[model samples]
Target: VRLRHALEVRSPTFDTQQFYDLAEKYGCAIVYAEDDEAPEWPKIDLETADFRYARLMSSKPDEPTGMTSAELDAIAKQTQAWAKRGDVFAYFIAGAKVRNPAAAQALIAKLA
Candidate 1:
């Protein structure tokens, strides 16, 4: 399982380490997400789990592929690192939803 959009995880009183420990124990992974609305959310390290789940929510409507080529490349690079360890699941789920397919294709091209 993958947990997403749980803002409480970022709360000061939240026991992050314990949460991770529990997640690991149950074979669950936290979604590593990027959101314009929640920029303060901490980034989840790729090493936290055996598999990765990333939600790319910073796509732009003006960009041809929902995101700039450079952004796609950067994501591909990071994905490569994650793939080296285990399975990688990435989704372009927000911002310019119409261009999500193109963004996904561009990322696949980069990964290729």
Candidate 2:
């Protein structure tokens, strides 16, 4: 299961290391979420878990593929690295929902 805003809210007082340890103990992967509004959200590294989960929430309506080429390239690189470690699950969950499909296709091509 992925923790969204809850993680952000609790980060101030919560023991981050303990949280990660618990997740690892339970065979759960904390999500790495990217959002323009919540740029300060903690970025969990791929090495922290056996599997990876990422949410790409910065897709823009003005961009043809929901994201800029540079953004796609960066995501592709990160995903590739995560794939080397284990399974990777990424989703374009917010912003310009209509362009999510295009963003996904673009990312796939970059990964290819």
lDDT of each: 0.77, 0.76
Q: Candidate 1: lDDT of 26?
A: 67
Encode model 2's per-residue lDDT on 51-90: one tens digit a residue. Answer: 7888888998889999889989999999998998888889
lDDT of 1 by residue, 1-112 (tens): 6553322244434337887776677666677877776777766663556778888888888888998898899999999998998888889988689988899999999988
Count of clashing pairs, candidate 1: 0
Off by over 4 Å in 2: 1-15
**Per-prediction TM-score:** 0.81, 0.82
**Cα deviation in Å at residue 60, candidate 2?**
0.4
What's the true lDDT of residue 37 in model 2? 65
